[model samples]
Target: MANVAISELDKNCGKVVAEIVKLERKIFPKHESLASFFENELKKKNSGLLYLHVDGELAGYVMYSWPSSLYASITKLAVKEQWRRQGHGEVLLKAAIEKCRTRKVSCIMLHVDPLRTPALNLYKKHGFQVDCLVESYYSSDRNAYRMYLDFDSS
Candidate 1:
């Protein structure tokens, strides 16, 4: 595995935005985050982005938001297909979790497609529990598990 570095994306970096869009399209062909929404998120004080770089390439990223003091929500997490199984996703996830802790959020929440077993297992390993089932959460054909990691407990 190549050494990976984590960096917070700067809102002013247009190049980073373009790279992110490209990666999103490849990783999430049907559910790509809109460029306008992504750009808007970059400008938000309560939102954050973490990028995992392997030898100067974008290996993965996590985008999250602290909409309120009570909870932090992970909007997206993706690792390049080539980077899967190398722990890049967890690295980005841990960084995002730490960022939430810094803001003193009570819990971190995320939704994952139920069919995505690998992702479900990853969240479970990180202390996230299924809070509920969100029917058609992602789209009409997809359902989701609403998982949460509470900071109040160990």
Candidate 2:
């Protein structure tokens, strides 16, 4: 397994953005707004894009936004097919969680497709709990589990 390096993306990240767009097409074929969405995120102070490079190659990325003081939302996360089980996703997720923690957010939340067992398992193993099921959350044909991790234990 190659060593993975995580980096915060910026406007000058054309090559990384291109790679992300390519992977987005493969991972979420129906989502055509990713390029623009990521670009906009690069310009937002409250939003972030983090990419993981394995052996100098783009392996995966995670995007998130701090919508409010109370919680941060994970907007998207994906690891290339070849890098799926090599701990890249967990690294990216942990990075995102740390980013949120720095902002003093009380909780971190994300929506995952119910059909994606591996992703669901990853989040669960990382201490996330399913908050509820949202029908047609992703689209009219897909449902989602709204999962959250609370930093404040009561």
Top candidate on lDDT is 2
Name the runs in model 2 displaced over 4 angstroms: none
Per-residue alpha-carbon lDDT of model 2 for 1-154, expressed as tens digits? Answer: 5676899997788988989988887888565347656566667789998999999999999999998999999988999999898789999999999998899999999999889999999999989999999998877888999999999961
RMSD of each: 1.3, 1.6
Q: Top TM-score: which candidate number?
A: 1
- Segments of candidate 1 deviating more than 4 angstroms: none
**TM-score on alpha carbons, each prediction:** 0.95, 0.93
Q: What is the C-alpha lDDT of each candidate?
A: 0.88, 0.88
Model 2 clashing residue pairs (backbone): none
Tell me the lDDT of candidate 2: 0.88
Model 1: per-residue Cα lDDT over 1-154, one tens digit each: 5767999988577887789878887778456455546787778999999988898898889999999999999989999999898888888888999998999999999999989998999999999999999998878888899999999994
Residue clash pairs of candidate 1 = none
Model 2 lDDT at residue 5: 85
